[model samples]
Structures are given as structure tokens and as C-alpha cells.
Target chain A: MRIALGAVAAVAYAVLLLAPLAVIVYSVSPGAALEIPPSGASLRWYAGLADQPRLISGLFTSLLLGAIATGAALVTGVPAALALTRGSLPGREAFLAVLLSPLSLPGLVLGLGVLTSAAVLANATGIRTAGTLLPLVAAHLLITIPWVVRSVAASLESTDPALEDQARSLGAGPFATLFLVTLPSARAGIVAGAVSAFVISFGNFALSLLLASGRTVTLPVAIYETVDRYQDPTVAAVSTLTIAAAVGAAVLTDRISGPLKTRDSSARSGQPAGPAALEPNR
Target chain B: MDRSRRRVAGLLLLPALLVVAVVAAAPIGLLFRVALYPPGPVAPLTGGPELDSFAGLLGAPYPSVALRTLRLSLLTTVLVTLLGFPVALFLSRSRGLSRRIQTLLIVSPLLMSVVVRAYGWMLILGRQGFVGETLAALSLPRVGLLHTEAAVLLALTESFLPFMILALAASLDRIDPDLLAAARGLGASSARTFFAVVVPLTLPGFVAGASFVLVGSLSAYAIPALLGGSAARTFVMEIYELVTISFDWPTAAAASIVLLLFASALLGGAALLSRRRSARTFGT
Candidate 1:
């Protein structure tokens, strides 16, 4: 029974690891058609990426959108995290629930909701928000802020409160103590949160689908379009690039947040560490 | 916390709260409002509040779509749980570099976009792809799995297995090893110890992970869009088609609300179940 279970697990793990790698391998296959055990491997499809203008532009848009959304999330989310962790706020659990509610919300529902609301606003105020980057940013913020708050809050919880108090006692004002002590100590969490926020926003598809116009198309949207229209290796090439970018982000997040995760006893106890803690509803 | 400090905290929280209220909360409210409106041919909201769209949703096609979605999600959840448990057990027992490598393998795929993953599945399941090629080599008919329910289920299970494994591993890690030793020392069999101790203890993680997979599969758009094609239309796909293709915003709004309610009910049920189980176990 144990051996059978082990065998099942090994196969499951192989499927989990190989499914994504299949795209990378297929992209490098030296043929126009997608086939396993290709005739030869080449970077021809990677070179073909330059010919796809929609995908190139979509990549840029996705990057810019991710950066802006991450920056905005950090600016708002860090302060809120500080307040939630250190402010001794009343109804803290309820407040946290409200802030993290979007994580549970289906991206389809959230996207439709944001789209309808944008339409309403456009009709009311005559300022179009649906086709622009505004609603995308807003929806991305809704999804990303929870990560920021959770990460920073977890980090802050592990630190000694007396450090901030000591700084205050040693002639540091509240703001000075916050900047020099509180924020500095939570830097790992902050960076991890920012990285996660950016990745979530960049790879987001359902929300971006509802909000993206021709001009605001993201890479995922472009890939969807390409796959819908054609069965070429270019889509595989694009997906491979996306996979590479995500792996890079995951590595960066681990490098920065590894020590903090080790220090987080609650994470060790039951909670999944890093970006896996909360489902981003990709 | 003094009043001034509390006030400062509130001030700090206002921006995020405002953004959520405007973007997240208000849009849901708008969806509800739009759903209530009478459906118009050209305009989504022509008349005052009515249930025409909701009534339409109860008729043919939509119910089947909802059922298909629920069926797919439930199947995906079960598949994920079954496959994830052993891996979670392995993860809980492993240490050091091995554990880190295993974690990276589990999580790196999650970081990639669903679209990319779905595209990968397309390659594997396509007519001239891996499965088909293997079948051809076996001198059998090449049957494309793409656009089938099985393909979607396979992809969904792959996408969500990491979540279940992580959740279960976390719970398994929290179990005291000595409890197992005590069970064995008390003359219990290994299976008996596992069934009585480990399974009950990990129930919360099981529920949490199952709910995530269930809800995620229900709301998934990319997998169904790419792999399911026209044959296995899901609830989210219905909502998307209604909004974009049919341009029936009121019906789409009604559909969105129904999906939201379904997801929330499942999550709430799981939360309640886990809480009650934990309370019973710990006597809290």
C-alpha cells in the first residue's frame, strides 16, 4: 500500500512539474507543428516573437500595469498594514476581513462587477473608465492589497514591539520611529508583497479580459487571442517566456523573504509561506 | 491605543478602504442593481427593478451550465484532494534542500499565468499532440482530448493540486509526532493511528484546500475557454459570452450574482464545517 501510494505521488509530481515544461519544450521544437520528440531543437520560435506586434505591445502594457498597480498597492497597503498591526485598532478582525475579502471573490465576478460599475460611472459622469487602465488598476489593487497587508502584518507580528517603543523612548518621534524602526524591520515582507503584487497583476487574465481594450491588451489576453485564432508554436513561445518570468519572480521572492518565513512561527505552525498563503484567484 | 493614535490609524487605512469600497464593493453592488433591472434589447437596464433576467436564468441552458460548472469543480476538488494528500504527507516529512526543491516544483507553476498553463495543456491534449501521437504510435485511433470535460478536469486538477498539498502539508506539519508514537505504543495499528489521529487533525486543511479548488474551478475562465472549447461550457464562460458576445448585460449580471452566491455558500459552508470540527476536537 505504501509503495502504491508513493508511486501515485511520484506520477502526480511528475505531471505537476512536466505540464508547464511541455510548453517550453514544444516552443523550441524545430518544426511549425507542435509534436512530442521533435526532429530538432531550435530558437526559431523565440526569434519569431519579434514579428508579433500585439504580443510585444501587450507585454509592455502588462509590465507597466503591473508596476503601477504594485506601487499603488504598496503605498496604500503598507500604511494599512502598519495600522492593522500596530495601531491597536478596534474591530481589527472585521477590518482585516473586509480588506482581504477580495481574495475570496471570483475574478470573473469581480471583473464583471468592476466593468458594470465602470459603465455606470461613465454613464453618470461621462468619463470613460472601462477601456482605459483605470478599472484594471482598481481591480488589480483590490486583489493585490490583501497580499501586502498579510505579508507586512505577518512580518510585523514576528518583530518585538519593544523595539518600536525603545525607539520612541530614545528621542525618536512617532513618524521617525515608524520610518527608522518599524518599516525597516519589515522590509523583507514589504519587498515580498511588492513582488507578489506585481506577479499577480501581470499574470491576471480574467479581470484583465473584462477590462482590456485593444490598446490596453495584456500578454495573457494576447496569448488567449493567439491560441483562439491559431495553433502555432508562437503561443507556446510566448507562454515559455511568461513561465520564465514567473520563475524569476518566484526566485526573487524566496531570496528576499526566506529568512522572514523561517522566523514566522505561525507560518511554520500552519500557514503556507510566501505568495502561496492566499489564493490570488488567477 | 489613544484616541489620537486611533485617529491616525483610521487616516492611514482610509485610502485602501476607499479604493476597495469604490472598485470592489461598489461594482458588486452595481452588478446586483443591473441584475435587478429589466433586460432590454439594446440597453441593459431599460426599466426599473425587476426579475426578468433572474427568471431567464432559471430557464433552459443556464441551469445546465451551472450544473456543468458545479460538476466540474466538484470533480476537480476530489481529484486534487486525492492526489494532493500523499504529496502533502511527503512534504510534511521531508526536510532541508529536498523540501525546498519540492516546494519550488509545486509553486512555480502557480506563479505562471493560467493562460500559459492552459496553452501547455493544449499542446498535450491537441489532436496531433502528445497523447494523440502516442495513440498513433500504438496503432490506435488518435482521439483528441481537447474540448472534452476530462481535459478540463485534468488541467484544473493540475492547476489546483499545489493549493491542496500546501494546505494539507501545513496541517500535517502541525501534528505532534509523539501522538502517533503514543497511538502505536498503546497497541494501535499504523492505519488505525492514521485514521483516528492524522485524518481528523488535518480535516480543517482538507476543507480549506477543497473549498479553494472548488471555487477556483467554478470561476475559472481560461481553462474552459481554451480546453473545453464549445463542448464543456462553464458558468463563467456563460457570463463572458452573455456580456461580450450576446451583449445581454442584464442576464450576464444575473449570472454573475448567481455564481457569486454559489461560491460564497460553498466557502461559508466549508468555514463553518472546519470551525465546528476544530471546536469539537479541541473543546474550544
Candidate 2:
């Protein structure tokens, strides 16, 4: 009975996940206009997507933005996370909360704030920032950095701080212990955080919508405009591709973050795979 | 030199602190400053910051938006928690393929961006969507789920459910099944065992899950914007419009501050709940 129930759940899960993709693919299928069912599917829309250079450009721009934002987040977020988790900073709890506070700010509101602040600065300095790529990237960082910090912080928090202290008691210097022992222990969390940052930045739409100009339009904003202008399945195709990338990142992160330990006994044994596994990195 | 070492720690954290201070805190502070002191019809800013925006928010439309956002988030949190708790419990008990399937169902949606999920729902709930077609097949009147409060509620529930599951699953993992078995041996039925043994044990996770969904729903933007229509206006939506469309900086800042305060309160409540659960568990 449990197995049967599990099967039902799995089927429902697959349908919920794959249904939208099926709709998009079917909508663009050849002979789809035939009354009851399409006789054949075609790759016409996939081919057509290539011809739209603007969309192709948007994909490139989005990739570039995701890269930049993830880099910025790692630079700022990882160190902050390490400090908060390890260092006995004053008011650490309050500091941690404030650092992670952006998580509770809606992306639209965050985007609005970024835009308004940029505009205020630009008007003050007679410089343009409203329709620039840098500002959009900056906005993405605002949202993505929190996930990076949170993930890394979790890993850092759970780790036995005594390990570093022990390493220091031996012959190792503080920096050496940090680089070798502390960082290695937090490696899994760092990787997970980085993956999240990448996906969060990549899939972001609100910031891009408000901030992107003709030159800086990312794929999500592109899809938004395309769908508004035309009810084409091509937009769906783009969305499918983006969603696929997101799922890929998520699954990879899950695998990297280590196996699910729904049971306490299972969690103890589900240690992260090391270099030898060559498994999907979180 | 030892003093310098301590300074090095501070120095190591300077860049991040600066970024947060400039980007996050400044905007929020600026938002409050602007909101309190709405710009004049001509100059945009005349005197010091005032409470006009706060006062304005207490009036009809803004208050209604705030209430609606709260109502939707509260409903979503409740629904997601109820469904999520059972699923998490099942996951904690299962193994192998069953566990994998459960994990996939729970985490797959988290993989999708809020925008894509919104788009998926748009396809599923739109006028010519699958739900409409299915209703037609049953000869039932098709209700439009899109561009309504229901759409917003459903989308928020879908997007936020995964977080609840994650939190609940984490907490459930901490509970010892032997305790449940022990309860069962004492003649407790399944329901009684669950309530008597499992629920109290996993209460921390339940609170964590509730808070995750609550805070998540409170801050969600794409779901509300994509699924809701004019009537389903949320506070976040108001803040966005004030900044982007109207360029009313003060009012936008005011709206943001209001949101910030409300979110802080909600999160604080969640934290307190988690702490209380842990304390209760330890006390027992």
C-alpha cells in the first residue's frame, strides 16, 4: 500500500512538473491545428528561436549578468558568512539577522529601491544609470547574496568550531587553519550557496524588468515582452529552457548538499561526497 | 600587532559590511526618510520628513492592500503547512525510491523561478488553460482562477510550500521514531501517537516551516504580480508602483518601511515560536 501510494505521488509529481513543458511543446508541434490530436511533433519552434537574435543576445546577457552577480555575491557573502558563523562578533545574532534581512524584502520592492536610488544618484551627478547593465547586475546581487550567506552560514554554523581551535593549538597559524580546516569543512555549504546564487541571479526577472534597457534586456524580461506582444509558444520554449536550467541547478545543489536525511539515522550517514565521487557538486 | 590581528578580522569583514550598509540599509533608511516627508507638488522635498505617507497608508486603499497581502499570505502559510507537515512526516518514515520520489515532489518546484512558476500557473489556470478545459469536459462551470485573489493565493502556496517542506523535513529528521513506537506500544492509536509523541517532538520544525512559508509569502513579488489583477493589489505591489511608475520616492520609501516593520514582526514571532518549542522540548 505504501509503494502504491508512493507511485501515485511520483506520477503526480512528474505530471505537475512536466505538464507545462508538454503544453509548450505540443502548441508548437507540426499539424497541431488538426482537430483532435497532432499527428506529428516538429522542432520548428526550436529552430525559429535561433533566428531571433535579440533573444539569443538576451540569453548571452543574462549569462553574463548571472556570472557577474554570483562573483560579487561570493566575494562579499562568503566572507561575511564565515565571520558571522565563526567570529565572536558583538551582537552576532542581530548582525546575522540584518545581513539576511534582504531575504524578507520582495524582489519587486528591492528592484524599485535600486532603481530609485540609482535615479537619485544619477540626477545628482548628471550621470545615467537607470537603463544600464551594471545596475541590473547590482540589483541581482542584492537578492542573490542573501541565499549565499544563508547557505554558507548554515554549513558554517553546524560545523564544530572546535576543529579550528584544535588546529590552531597544534602548529597551524590562524590563516592556515582557516584555509585548510575551516574552509574545507565549509566547502560543501559554500558550493551549495554559490549554486543558489548563480540560479537566483540567472532566473531573476523583476530587477531586469525595471532596470534593463534595449542593450541590457535579459531573457526573463525578453520573455515577458514577447508574451505580451505575441501569445507565441516560442516564449514558452524560452521559459521551458530557463526552467530546465533552474531545475538542473537545483538538482545539482541537492546532490551536492548531500542526500536528503529525512530520518535522523539517515542524516548521520549521508555525509557529502568528496573529490573521488565526481558526483554533482551542490 | 595583536590589536592589528583583531583589526584584520574587522578588515576582512569591511567590504561586505560596506556593501550592505550602502545598498541594503541605505535604501531602507532613504525609504523611511522619503515616506515621512513626501515631496511637494513642485520641489518634491520641502521640509523635514513627516508622517503623511503613514497616515495615507492608514486610509482606505493602502490599508486594504496591506490587509489583502496579509490575508493571502496567512492563508497560504496555513494551507502549505497543513499539507507540508504530513508530507514531511511521510518522508521521514519512508526510504529508498519512496524517499527519492517525495524529495523530488517537494524540491522540484523550488528549482523553478517564481516567474516560471507564475507562467506555469498562468497556462494551467488561464481562460483557455488546462483547468478550464477539464472543467468543460465535466460539464461544470469553469471558474477563472487567473487575475484574481485565488490565483495569488494558489501561486504563493505552490512557490512557498517547498520551503515549509524543507524546514519540516529537517525538523522531522531530528525526531526519533523509537519514541513513536514507544507511544504505540502503550496502546496509543496512530492518530494519538502522532499527536502525543510525534507532534510535540517535531514542533520546532513545524514552527520553522510555518515561519519559512509565512516570511516567504510575505516577501514574494513575482507570484503576486503575475497571478493577481488590479483588485488583488498587495503592499509589495504598491511599493513597486510608487517607486517605478509614480517615481514618488517618499511614498515608496514609506511603503517599504511599513513592509519592513510588518515582515520583522512576523519573523520575530516565528523566531520566538521556534525558541519556545525548543525550550518546551528541553524542559520535558
Q: Give the best candidate by lDDT.
A: 1
Model 1: residues with Cα > 4 Å off, grouped in runs: A1-5, A270-272, B137-139
lDDT for each residue of candidate 1 in A1-282, tens digit (9 for 90 to 100): 657656776888898877788788888889877654467899988899899899988999999999999999999999999999988899998899889888888897898888888877788999987668888889899889998999888878888889999998999998899899999998888888888899999999988898888889999999998988787887788788889988888778766765556666654674545687666676
lDDT of candidate 1 at residue A51, scale 0 to 100: 94
TM-score of chain A of each: 0.94, 0.83
Compute the interface RMSD for each candidate structure.
1.7, 5.3
Best by DockQ: 1
Lowest lDDT block of 10, candidate 2 chain A: A273-282
Cα lDDT tens digits for candidate 2, B135-154: 76677887668889998887
lDDT of 1 at A83: 92
lDDT scores in order: 0.86, 0.68
TM-score, chain B, predicted structure 1: 0.96
DockQ computed for model 1 against the true two-chain complex using alpha carbons: 0.68
Question: In candidate 1, which residue pairs get closer than 3 Å at backbone N, Cα or C atoms, i.e. clash?
Answer: none
